[model samples]
Target: MKGFTSYAIKNLKSTGSIARSSKFLARNLAKQVPTDAKTIVELGAGDGIITRELLKYMPQQAHLTSYEISEELLALLQRIDHPRFSLKHSSAMDIVQDFAIDSVDCLVSCLPLALFPLEMKHELLTHIRSVLKPNGLFLQYQYWLSDKQLIKEYFPHLKTNWVPLNLPPSFVYTGTAPNSELVAE
Candidate 1:
């Protein structure tokens, strides 16, 4: 609760910020979060490092909704006073029920998707796809490619990029939801 590093170390398994060394990664991640996005949701908002960076770049009309189940991390996130920012003590899977379908412009996830159980991971990805706008962006970072195929199932248009500056390094996966009309055809 004291800081990003302390909270991450104390709750290593649950906290997504394994290392307080994501400065460069956060910057790049923030850059990818559509600036014109009217609504943005961030999953696993670890201590608001990336959230803070997002505030700096998001358009004046944009709003960032961050989700963090860890109270310790949430406390730090709450300290970031910004009119355009909001925090949710919830999980990514609830997104569909929490927001309207096709409402989100971008969803940035720092969650350890590879570690999630297969069924839960699929469920969450499904929810993400349902809540995203037709042209929405799904930006997720992970240390491994275990969830690559699962993500592909939900978002056929996908690209992967490496962020070597992050601690332990990570891959940034950018994806867009598949067109429902095309799938139906």
Candidate 2:
């Protein structure tokens, strides 16, 4: 636990917490992962804590693709040993390169959007919108509410839940994809 916390602090941008996420938070985030989902993707899957929690809800036939930018943490995630789990060493910003349009059923993101620059945030949201199915779910947890309006621009049906069990408390954002045709029309 000590070493993991050190790693998380060292990589705050990716891990987004001083301590690893509590199982309570993990459970709350994973709760929305329906058993019927075929593909689940995780961004900044720190130490695979949430990664493991996600697996418990995943159907055996489902595949989970996790992206972890911290090389040190990648070693921990590799120990997952699940037949359907795969790890990628890349940033979520480049997700479009690896996936086709409307490919992801759910994207569980641990990225710290609050710390991102405005332009980078826009780029990330655009890339995120590209990969999600029209009905796809986007789950994100943050310590601040500053970015809610920005996210609403892309995901019109955004809602939130607050989890005070974490070390610093957090807000979980659940959003449905925006209607592109609504904009086009």
Q: Which candidate achieves the best lDDT against the true structure?
A: 2
lDDT of 1: 0.83
User: Each model's C-alpha lDDT?
Assistant: 0.83, 0.85
| Model 2 CA deviation exceeding 4 Å by range | 181-185
| Residue-wise C-alpha lDDT for candidate 1, range 33-135, written one tens digit per residue | 7767899999998778789888887878999999988777778788899998888998777788789999999999888887778888877887888889997
Off by over 4 Å in 1: 181-185
CA lDDT for candidate 2: 0.85
Give each model's clash number: 0, 0
Per-candidate TM equals 0.92, 0.93
Q: What is the lDDT, from 0 to 100, of the residue 134 in candidate 1?
A: 91
Compose the digit string of candidate 2's lDDT tens values, residues 23-142: 988989888886778889999888888999999877767899999887788888888998889899988877899889899888999888888899988888888888988878899898
